[model samples]
Target: MKEKIIETSIELFDRKGFKETSVQEIVEAMGVTKGAFYYYFKSKEELLRDICLTYIEDLLQQQERILRDENKDCTTKLYEIVYMLIHNIRTRRKSARIFFREMRHLHEEHLQEIKAKRRAFRENYQKLIEEGIAEGEFKQTHTPHMVTFGILGITNWSYYWFNPDGEISEEKLAEIYVDLILNGIKNREGK
Candidate 1:
């Protein structure tokens, strides 16, 4: 019952922005009474927070697996991380939209918790870039901090337009993005 509410709420929240989605609408969609919702979540915002936590927690677990792998190099891990994010968008599009677009609606305490987890993910990403640079696999031209944000900026923005079933597979997109990060678009002959 709790899971159903979360899933149904995600659908409604995805279609109708968080502010626009009402607790009434959530219960109505599930053919349950408000008491049922109140039983599981204190408020609509709490439900949103749960959705955010579920999404980020799942990502963090996947990231830990990739980050801790002994056989993969920084470059491969980087691609896998980016690919994981893109693949998640396909799998969790509603959760992705709510996590990114509707997070502003979360309350202060919940927002802080979410931010901390986000920082953890960012730190791991930065760690990868720093490792790549230290190992001479990536160029030393950019700061790992900014480079992490840059990679995130590029990949995160894909939720707005990326199509998993489009001509470009998620794997290809990851490769293309990693290539762009590793090798700039400017032609050598132009210089």
Candidate 2:
């Protein structure tokens, strides 16, 4: 019952912005009573916070697996990280949208926690870029923090318009991002 409400709420929140979605609408859409909703979540804000936390937690877990694995090189792990992000966006589009779009709706206290997790996630990627630079795999011209943020922005922003059902698969899309990040946008005269 709790899972159903959260899943339905995520769909509603994505379709209708968080501010536009009401407790009544959530319960009505799920055909659950107010008592049931309150039993699972204290308030709409709490539910929103749960949604945000769940996303950040899941992302961090996946990143940890990639980062902590010594078997993969920095470049391969970087590619896998981007691939996982793209796969998450495609497989969990509603959750992805709510995560990126409605996070600002969270209150200050919850916002701080969410921001901390976000920073940790970004830092993981930053460390990857720094490792690549250290290993001489990536160009040293750019700062790791800047490259991390750029990679994040490019990948996360795809949620706004990316259609997973389109011709391109997540792996291919990841390759495109990896290529862009490693090689950059400028055209080279020779291969």
Candidate 3:
């Protein structure tokens, strides 16, 4: 029941935006009474917070697993993370959209918690870039801090229009994106 409510809310919130989505609308969509909603979630805001937490917590867990794998170096781990996020579009599009586009509605306290988890995600990527540099797999020309943001910007914004089923597969998209970042699009050794 709780999962159904959350799933319905995500679909509605994705289509109508969080501020526009009302408790009445959510309950109506779920064919349940407000009491049922109140039983699982204290308030609409609490439900939004749960949505935010669920999205970021799953990401952090997946990230931790990738970060822990000693078999893959920083570069490989970077690809895995990028592919992981892009691949999520197929399964978690609405939730991802909400987490990215609709999170401003969360209360200040809830906002802070989500922000911290988001920061951890960014910091972990930054650490991966730093590791790549230290291992001489990546160049020293760019700062990992900015590079991390650059890479993140690419992966994060991909949610807007990247089609995993399009001509470019998600795997290919990740490869191209990571490749572009690792190796600039410039034509070296110009004739």
Candidate 4:
């Protein structure tokens, strides 16, 4: 029941925006009563916080695994990480929308928690870029953190525009990102 409520809330929040979604709508959609929602969540804010926490926690765990994978080279692992994010967005589009677009609605403490998790994800990628630099796989000309944020900004914001039914496959999109970051946009003939 709790899972259904949360899942329903995610759909509502994603489609209607967090502020636009209300308890009545949720209960009506779920065919449940107000008492049921209060039984599991003290308030809508609490439920929103829970959703954000769950989303960020899952992302953190996935990133930890990506960093810890020893079987793949740094380059392959980096591309895989981006591909994983693209796939996640495609399948979990609503959750991704709520997580990224509705985070500002959380209270201060809850906001801090989500922000910390977001930082961890960025830091993990920055660490990977640093490792690549050390291995001579990436250029030392640019700051790793900036590059990491740039890559994240491009890939992460794709939730706003990316279409699962589009022509581009997740792997191809990831490769394009990887190539853009590593080789850059300049034409070889000019140089």
TM-score for each model: 0.97, 0.96, 0.97, 0.96
Residue 7, candidate 4: how far off, in angstroms? 1.1
* Cα lDDT over the full model 2: 0.92
By TM-score, is 3 or 4 better?
Answer: 3
Error of 2 at 168 (Å): 1.0
lDDT of 4 by residue, 61-170 (tens): 88788889888777987898888888887667888889988999998999998999999989999999999999888888999989998999988898888886799887
Candidate 1 per-residue C-alpha lDDT over 148-183 given as tens digits, one digit per residue, 9 for 90 to 100: 999999998898899999999999999999989888
Q: Identify the runs in model 4 with alpha carbons over 4 angstroms from their true place.
A: none
Q: Cα lDDT for residue 120, model 1?
A: 96
In candidate 3, where is summed lDDT lowest over 10 consecutive residues? 156-165
Q: Given candidate 3, what's the lDDT at residue 74? A: 85
Q: Residue 129 in model 3: shift from native, Å? A: 0.5
Model 1 RMSD in angstroms: 1.0
Candidate 3 C-alpha lDDT tens digits along 15-80 = 999999999999999999999999999999999999999999999999889999999988899999
Off by over 4 Å in 3: none
In candidate 1, residue 158 scores what lDDT? 92
Query: Model 2: per-residue lDDT, tens digit, 143-187?
Result: 889898899999998888888889998899999999998888787
lDDT scores of the candidates, listed in order: 0.93, 0.92, 0.92, 0.89
